[model samples]
Target: MTVLPEWPAGTVAVLSTGAGAPHAIPVSTAIRRGDTQLAFALALRRESLVRLREDPRCAVVLLAAGLAITVHGRAVVERELERIAVVRVDVESIQDHQSPRFEIDAGVAWHWTSEEAQSGDAETRAAVSQP
Candidate 1:
């Protein structure tokens, strides 16, 4: 197995699903498992989750902390909790898209506007972290 580059927790990434048009969404809960696997949780009602259920093929784009790469893989629904679906991606390829012309200084910033949402996010992250 190919070990993937280590990315920090909460590293901003875009999860792309589907085949033709490709539905993409910003995901902040992505976590690296060991070396070759990445995992994230999505709300059960999210259309992206539905699309992923239909097509396991997906890609995660990361452009943060001076790194720019696209991780392509196949996703599998590992489990489902009360309100979120935990998905694990078995990484197949890591394509570097970095250029010397420019450098990335930081990752996408995110803030919660409501305490309820923040609490829920924390719970989701905890669930995703479980074995």
Candidate 2:
């Protein structure tokens, strides 16, 4: 079982390359009913994809109100574009800064493999669609 962080909806997320620089963007995301999973989409430029191809490790910082969640994981470029690329971030470790006893666990991150994600989504949809 994986333990995930608790973050509210519509939070701003800061994504940092393996380098020192960072980019902040508003997140349109989905979190599992429990703290088990999370998924978000990010658009990037050709340069960004190239950079990620060279360095797959990245960090995501989510902040809402005063609460914050910091996650470290591997990033994958799903689609490349002239002006934009779609990137998926798989959480490796998640931390809640506001919590005194912050939790950091493996559930934060996932294997960013297309097959795994697609199969998981298919199964989830099937289960949900069942009466």
Candidate 3:
């Protein structure tokens, strides 16, 4: 099982077939309960959600400082309220791009419970810039 460290706020690159091109959407994410799960907010009209419904396969890349983690997984969308939607991902594998660190192998289920969900949205401007 690949144990991924907490995903800092960043743009999530969601692969979808509906648009005929992969869409990279900037989203805010929070990890609750010791990396047990991740929570993010999204607008109601985003195409990625629909794509996820059609196909669960996706990827998320997070970079902070010089460290980067690229993850490939199957995502299941949970709740939808107004413009906010929560997504749960079953992580299949992750690649650390910074220095060739440990890699998360296959067959790993990334679970997220309601209690561990964070309550707010991620800051867009803060997440998009690299420092």
Candidate 4:
């Protein structure tokens, strides 16, 4: 089993799948549930959710300062909320993509433009963090 390392605050995660022509999306609420498990929340209207439902095989690329890790896993919808769905990924393999040539100064930064959206994101993150 692959063990996940501790992710820094503000780390960015991109969830991807090969369901059809390769689909990927940046997920902001991703968090490590355990050494070999990860969880994140996705909006119900997201197309990536549909693809995940069709095919659970997926991967999450986590990027942070001076670190890049790719986690291969199978995803399953764990809970359905009013506006979002909590998905859990059971890790299969972890690959460190960081190199000695260069260093990543920072991870991707994103901000919510609306207060309502920001509040919703906080709620989603809280929900995903629950046991």
The local distance difference test score of each candidate is: 0.86, 0.53, 0.52, 0.87
Which candidate has the top score in lDDT? 4
- What TM-score would each prediction reach against the true structure? 0.90, 0.52, 0.61, 0.91
How big is the positional error of residue 104 in model 3, measured in Å on the Cα after superposition? 20
- Candidate 3 Cα errors over 4 Å, as ranges: 7-19, 30-37, 100-131
Instruction: Give the per-residue Cα lDDT of candidate 2 at 11.
Output: 43
lDDT of 2 by residue, 1-131 (tens): 14665655434466667543553444334332344334444445434455567888876776655556677777765554343444666677777676657543322322326987666544433332222
Assess candidate 3 and give its TM-score to the true structure.
Answer: 0.61
Highest TM-score: which candidate? Answer: 4
Clashing pairs in 1: none
Question: Which residue pairs clash in candidate 3?
Answer: none
Candidates sorted by lDDT, best first: 4, 1, 2, 3
